[model samples]
Target: MARIAFILLCHKDPKAIIRQAEQLTAVGDYISIHFDARAPKDAYAMIRDALADNSNVTFARKRIRCGWGEWSLVQATLHAVEAAVEAFPRATHFYMVSGDCMAIKSAQYAHAVLDADDVDYIESFDFFESDWIKTGMKEERLIYRHWFNERNQKTLFYRSWWLQRRLGLERSVPADLQVMIGSQWWCLRRRTIEWILDFTRKRRDVMRFFRTTWIPDETFFQTLVRHLVPEPEIRTRTLTFLMFTDYGMPVTFYNDHYDLLLSQDYLFARKISPEAGQLKERLGRLYASDRTDFKISDEGRKLFQFLTGRGRIGRRFAPRFWETETSLGRERELMIIACKKWHVAKRLVGSIKHHTNLTAIDYLFNEEDTPLPDLGGIQTTLEKRTRHRRALMRMLFDYHETDRLIFCIDTANLDLMQDFFSDRSTTRLLEIACEFTDEYLAGHAKRVGLAGEETSDETLKQLLPTIRYDVVFEADRIRDAGFPNHGKIRERNTPEENAARIAEFLSVPEDTARSIAQTPYLFAD
Candidate 1:
C-alpha cells in the first residue's frame, strides 16, 4: 500500500487549513497536521470537524512555530513520519505534501511519475561547488536568511565558520537544477526515508547549527542527504502545484521565458490575486472548463482546483467532463467511411451525432452491413484506407473548408500496419496523401523516448528526439479497416497484403519484408 503522509503546518490561518482539509477529503486522502501551539483551541476543533470524515488524518501533539532554520520543521516531519510508520510502516512509499496542494485525477499519472523508471520530479536551478561534489543552489537563494538570535552565537555564525573552514563544504551542480527548486514537497520510497533517518543519526554539528538558524527547513534535508549519501537525490526546488512568496519578495519565473505556464503541459499558474480574475476567466475559456469565479488571491485554491478537478483546460480539447451534448452541423455534413459493419456503424454514428462540435467532423463511414458494437457512450468513428486516406487528405488540402472530418478505425486490429495491409498495398495512397498535405497535420488540434537501439540498414540511423509517436497503432487501425467500414478496403489481412503495403509504403522490393523485420523499427522496435 502507498500511504501519503500529508503534514499541514497549521498557521493561524484557519481558513487555509479548513480548505486544504476539504480538498484532501474530496480525494479520500488523509493528513496529519502540526498546528502552531499558539493557535486557538477553536481553530483545532474547526480543523478537526472539517477533516473528520477522513480516517487518515490526526492532529499531532508537538506544537511549534513553523519557521526556517529552526528545528521545528525537522521535528514536525519526524513526528509525522513516526505517525506514518506506526499507522503503516509497511507502506510501499510515503509522499509528503503540504496542506495547500490538492490532487488532479489520474492516479495512474501519479503512479507513473513516482515509478523508478522516471527520476524524481525535481527542478534544480542554481549550482554551488567544493570541486568533485555537486549540490543545487546558486547565487540566488544563497543568502536569504539572517538570524539575530543571541542563542545563535553557537549556531548561526559559529556553525557557518565550522562548515566553511573545517569541512570545506561547497559544491556545484547544473544551473537548470537551480530553477526547479524541488520543494520539501516530495514522494519518497519507504527505504529512502528510513535511510535518511538513519543517515542523520551521526551528524551532530549539522543538527546544532540547524537549531538556531532560519530556513533550516530549506537546507537541512538537502544538505544532510547530499553530503552523506553518495547520490543524495535531494531536490533544491519545489514541484508542487502551489508556491508561496512573501509580499516583498520578487519572484521570477526563470526570466520571462514563456508566455504562459499552461496546465496542459507540466504547469498551471496558481496564486493569482482576486484582481486577476480576468486571467482566471480567460483560462476557463481557453481550456473550456466550467471553472469560473477566479480567485486572484487564493493560490492554494487555484492549485487545488487545477490538481483535483476538470478546469476549462480539460474541457477545451476533451470536454466530455463538462457537457455530454455534441453538435450536428446544419447540412448533416458528415462523411462516414465503414467497411461492412452496420449494426455497430449505426450505433457509432448515433453516438457521434449525440455530442460533436457544430460545423465539425464532416466525413463519416457507413456503407458496410457489418454489426457495429453499440459503444454505450464512449466516442468513436470509422477507419480510413490507403486510397481513401489520400482522397480525404487531398480534399482537405484542396478545399480547406471541409468543415471537420474524423477517420475512425476498429480497435485491436489497429495494432501494427501488417495487420491492416495483410493482403493490400498502400504505397500509392501514401504518396498521394503526402502530395496533398504537408508532413504536418491540419484537421484539428488533438489534445495529445530515449535512447539506444540500433537498426540494421547503415543508412537507417537512430531516430531523432521527438514527442511524436510513430502512429504505429493508429496506422495499423487504418490498415486493418479493409477500406472504410463501408466501402471496399482491398487490403487483405495476410502476409501477401503485408508484403505489398510494406513495399508500397517503404518503396522497397517485395523481398524486403524479411529484411524490414530485422530493422527493429518495423515491429517490436
Candidate 2:
C-alpha cells in the first residue's frame, strides 16, 4: 500500500483531534501532530496520551507557539512535516489539516484520488490579480511592516511602513520569488514537500521577507510550490469544504447543513463545533463503513447522482404546471403571491387592495381544496395534487416571464422557495411573516403559529445567499397600516424606519415601501 503522511496542527478540541488521528490511521500511513505551545500543558498531554499507543502516530519534538497570521503557524507546519518524513521515510504524499477538519469521504477514496493524480492539490492564485484583500486592510497587510511583540503577538511597529518603500527602507522580495496567496490546507507529494523544505532552508532572505508579512501561512508554501512546480502540475482546488461568514471566520456546521455538506465534492469539512448536534457521531458512522477500495454502494451512488444532477430523479419529479402569458405585457415589478391557505391568501389580497394601487397579482397554491378568485380558473394539474412545494416554485420561476419578480411567500415556504430562486439571474425579494411577541403567536391559530416559528429559524439561517433583502413583519409597523395590536411594539426599527432601507434597496419611495412592508398578504382579488 502507498503510504500517506498527515501533518495535523491543532490548538483546541483534543478529543476531536484524537478521533481524526485514529480514523486516518492506516497500515502504511503516518500521522504527525504539533499542538500549539501556548495551549495548556494538560490539554497537550491529553492529546499526546491518546495517540501514544499508536505506533504510526508521532509528535513533533520542536513545537512552535502557533499564532494566527504569524510565521509561527508556517514553522509549526514545517516541524510537523519534518517529523512525519523522519518517522516514515517511505511516505509518498503529505496532507496538512487542522484539528477542526473532519474527513467526509473514506480514506481509501482519498488515497485512490491522490494516487491517480500527479498534480499537487494546492489552491493558489496571484495576490495582485484581483481585489482578494478585504476592505481597507490590504495596504497594512502587504505594504506595512507588522512586527511581533514580546509575547509573539502581531503588532504594527510603524503605521507608515509604505513610505519606507519610497525612501528605500523596505526589504524587497527575492527577485526569483513570485508572491502567491491561497488556502493554507493542501496535499502535496513528498518530493514537493522536500523541495519546499530545501527552498526555505537555502533562502533565509525569502523566509525573513515573509516573516513580517500578514498571514504568511496562506502565502509562504503557496508561493514556493507555485514557483518551483509547473502550472500544469498544480491543481487549484483543495479537498476541504470551508464556509465563511461576512466577518471572515469559518461558519460552524450544524444539523441543517447535513444535506449541503454531502452535496459538496470535497472530501473534508472544517470547524465542526460540538454545538453542531450529532454531527461528529454522524461523521463517525459514515467513516465506519469506509472500505480500502474506492467503490461506493448503490444507495450512496444514487444520492451522489441526485445531488450532482446526473440522475433521472429530477425529471421524474418535475412539476406539472404550465406558464400563461401576462396581460400587463412588460411590467418591471411582478408580485408573486405564494400561499398555502386560502384564508391567508384572501386576507393578503385584501391587504394589497388597501395598501397598493395594483389591481392584479399572481397567486400560486399547493393544496387542491384552496379556492381561487375568478379572474380565470386556469388550474394546473399540480395545484389539485398533493403539496410539491419545491416543484411548484421551480415551475413558477421557469414559466413566469418577468423582469423583476417580487415573491410574497409565507413563513412555511420560505426555505424551499429561496432554493428555487437561488440560481435565477432576475431580481427578487422574499418577505417573511414575523411575529414580534408570544402574544402575536397566541392570537393566531395553531397552524399559523407553527408556521411563524419555522419561518423565523429558516430566515435567521440566511440560507439564500443570492437574495440581498428580505422583509420582516413588525407589529407596530403593520399597526400604522390598520392592523390590530397583537403584541406590544418594541423600540426596534419599525416598518416606517425601514422605509428608507427598502426604498434605497428597491429604488422606490419610502411611503410606497410601506405598502410592501405593511401588507403581509397580497392575494388576487
Candidate 3:
C-alpha cells in the first residue's frame, strides 16, 4: 500500500480542525499539523488531547506566528512539511491543505489517482503574464519590504510610496528566479518535497527575500516547483475546490453546496465550518463508500443546467425576446444591465445603486408580458429578438459606445458578452452573479419549466458556448464595490457586517448604509 502524508495548517476552530484530522486517520497514513503560534495555548492542548489516541497524528516541533499576507504562512507550511517527512520517511506522496479542508473523494481513490501519475499536482502561472494580482499592486507586493509585528499586523513605516519610487529604494525580485504564483494548496511527490527542502536550505538569500514579500506562501512554492520540476512532471491543476467572495474570503461550504461539490472533479473542498457538522458527516460517509465514482451525479447535472442555462433535458427554451430600440442616444459613462432573469437583474441593480450614480439598463430576451416592479433608475429595453443569442448581443454592442461602462447582471451570458466586447478596449465590464444556495434549486426549476422531449447535440453545442463565461472576479474587488451576496450560498455575511463594509468603502453613515443595503434597488425619490 502506498503511504500518504497530510500536512495541515490550522489557525482557529479546533473542533473543526480535529474533525478533519479524524477523517484522514488511517493505516499507512501520517497527519502533521502546525497550529498558529498566536492561537491560545489551551486550544492547542485541546486538539493535542483529542488526537492523543491516533498514532498517525503528530504536531510540528516548531510553530510560526502565522499572519495573513505575510511570510509566516510560508514558514508554517514548510515546518509542517519538514515534520511530516521526518515522521513518515516511507510516505510516497505529501499533501498540504488547510485545517478546514475535507476530502470529497475516498482516500483510496486519491491514492489511486496519484499512483497512476508520477507528476506533481500544483497550480502555477508566471506573475508578469497573468492578471492574478490587481493591476498596480503587483509591484507594491514584490518590490517593497513589508514587515509584520507579533500580532501579524502590517506596519506602515513608509508613508510616501511615491518617494520610495523616486529614490528607487525598493529591491528588485531576484533576476535569476522566474516569479510564479498560484493557490497555496498542493500535493507533491516525495522526491519533489525532498528537493524543495534541499534547495531552500542552500538558498538563504531566496528565503530572506521571500520573507519580505507580501503573501510569500502563494509565490514561494510555485516559483521553486516551476524552477526545479520538469514540465511533463508537473500537473498545473490543484485538487481542491475553493470559491472566493468579492471580499477576499474563501466561500464556506454548506449542505447546499452538495451538488456543486459533486460537480467538481476536485478531491477536496476547503473552509468548511463546524456548524455544518451534518454536511461533514454526510461527506465522510460518502467518502467511505466504494460505489461513488468521480462522475457528476444527476442532481449535479441539473445544477449545471440551472447555472449556465445549458443541458435542458427535454425543452427547447429560447432566450427571452423583446423588441425595442432605446439607445442612450449619446454614450453614457456607465450603464448596468441584466439578461432575461428579472429577479437577478433587480438585485444586482440594487447592490450598486447607492454606490454609483449610473443608471441601470435591462436587456430583456423575452417579451414583456407582465409588468416589472419599480427598479429605481433601472430602464428596460428589448434586445433584438433572434434565434441566436450572439446576434442580440451584437446589437447591444452596436448600440453602446465602446468606452461605456457596462455592468452585466448575471454570468449566464458572460461568454457571449466577452466575445462580442473583446475588441472594445475602452468598455468597462463588471459582471454580477448571484451565489445564493436556493438560486441553484430555482435554476433547476426553471430548467424543468423549459424542458423539451429532446435536445439535439447541435443545439447543445451552440447553446453551451454562448451561455459559458470566461470572466473571473476577485473577492476583494467585489467586496469593495458593496455587493451584498457572494462566495458560498450558505455562509452569507450578516447585514450589519455588510453595511459596515459599505460604510467604510463609501464613507457613509452606518444607518444610511444599512438603509441602502436593505433594498436591492435604489429608491427613486
- Among all candidates shown, the one with the greatest lDDT: 3
Error of 3 at 466 (Å): 20
Per-residue C-alpha lDDT of model 2 across residues 366-456, encoded as one tens digit per residue: 4433443332234444333223443333334345543444444443443333334333233234232332343333223224221222233
Evaluated with TM-score, which candidate comes out highest? 3
lDDT of 3 by residue, 244-308 (tens): 65456677777755545654667788867667777788777665565445553323334333444
Candidate 3: where is the Cα deviation over 4 Å? 149-163, 297-525
> Which of candidates 1 and 3 is the stronger one according to lDDT?
3
Candidates sorted by lDDT, best first: 3, 2, 1
* lDDT per residue (tens digit) for residues 1-525 in model 1: 233455556456576667555544333345667776666888877777877766666667666655544567777876666666565544545556554333432333344445533223333322244221123223323332234332445566455644554665533332322212224555555666677677557655445555544444555555544444344454333445444333323232321111233322222332333334344344333323323222122123332233233222211122232122322323322333232222333333343344333221222332242333333312133444222333333344234454433333332122222222322222122200111111121110111101111211111111111112233333344555554322222222344554454344333466664243223221110
TM-score computed on alpha carbons, candidate 3: 0.60
Ordered by TM-score, highest first, the candidates read 3, 2, 1
Q: Estimate each model's TM-score.
A: 0.39, 0.57, 0.60
For candidate 1, the lDDT comes to 0.39
TM-score for candidate 2: 0.57
Note the clash tally of each candidate: 87, 3, 15
lDDT of each: 0.39, 0.59, 0.63
Where model 1 places Cα greater than 4 Å from the true spot, the runs are 25-28, 116-127, 130-182, 227-238, 241-525
RMSD of 2: 15.3
